[model samples]
Target: MKLSLKVNGKKIEKEVDDNTLLVSFIRENLNLTGTHVGCDTSQCGSCVVHVNGKSVKSCAMFAVDANGSEVTTIEGLEKDGKLHPVQESFKKHHGLQCGYCTPGMVMSSIDLLKSHKNPTEEEIRKGLEGNICRCTGYQNIVASVKGAIGKV
Candidate 1:
């Protein structure tokens, strides 16, 4: 299948297999390895990316399904020389440990903050239901989200 889409503000078009997952295309074809694949079964949100401004698991979607859409991976989250607010917040709050799930956590938190500029602690926890961080215990992750609430 031939797929065409905008990725990280760049236009992308390539031929791919019908079964090629979005994560594979991003990491293999585009060479954006920041989006990790922790659990291919979609149990872990490690492969999360933004599809048309919404958070979606790259492992759960096919490359063909992303055709004509705009996709944003963790590598795309930065602008020029500055890190995205979510990334900065995570760093400042120590939201990551092993760093395997940091990309998805940032992506999902961006979406959560978009909808709720001032989300409460409970709301932040609930919004992160899809993402799992094995090392942080979620306290710092929640603080990271709270810190980035108005910045995003």
Candidate 2:
């Protein structure tokens, strides 16, 4: 199957297997490895990416399904020489420890802030329920989200 989509603001057209997962397309074809594959299963949010402005688990969707959609991976969050506010907040608040889940966390956080302009601590926690960070105990992660609420 042929897939065409806007990835990180760049139009990309490529041939892919019908069964190829979006995660595989992003990592193998696009060479954007920031979107990690921690677990092939959907239980892990490590493969989360924005598809047309909403976050979806890349591993759960076929690459062909993403054809014509606008996709944003972690690499897309950075602009020029500056990092996204969420990325900066993660660094300022020490949101990650092992860093395996940071990319997805940052992606999810951006989507969360988009929906909830001023989310409370509880709302932030509920919003990120889909993403899991084994390291950092989530304390700093939550703080990072809260700290970035105004900036994002």
lDDT of 1 at 8: 97
Q: Candidate 1, which segments miss by more than 4 Å at Cα?
A: none
**Number of clashes found in candidate 1:** 0
Clashes of each: 0, 0
Candidate 2 wrongly placed segments (more than 4 Å): none
TM-score of each: 0.98, 0.98
Report how far off residue 126 is in candidate 2 (Å).
0.9
In order, the Cα lDDT scores of the candidates are 0.95, 0.94
* Residue lDDT tens for model 2, 10-73: 9999999998999999999999999999878888699999999999999999999999999999
User: How far off is residue 64 in model 2, in Å?
Assistant: 0.4
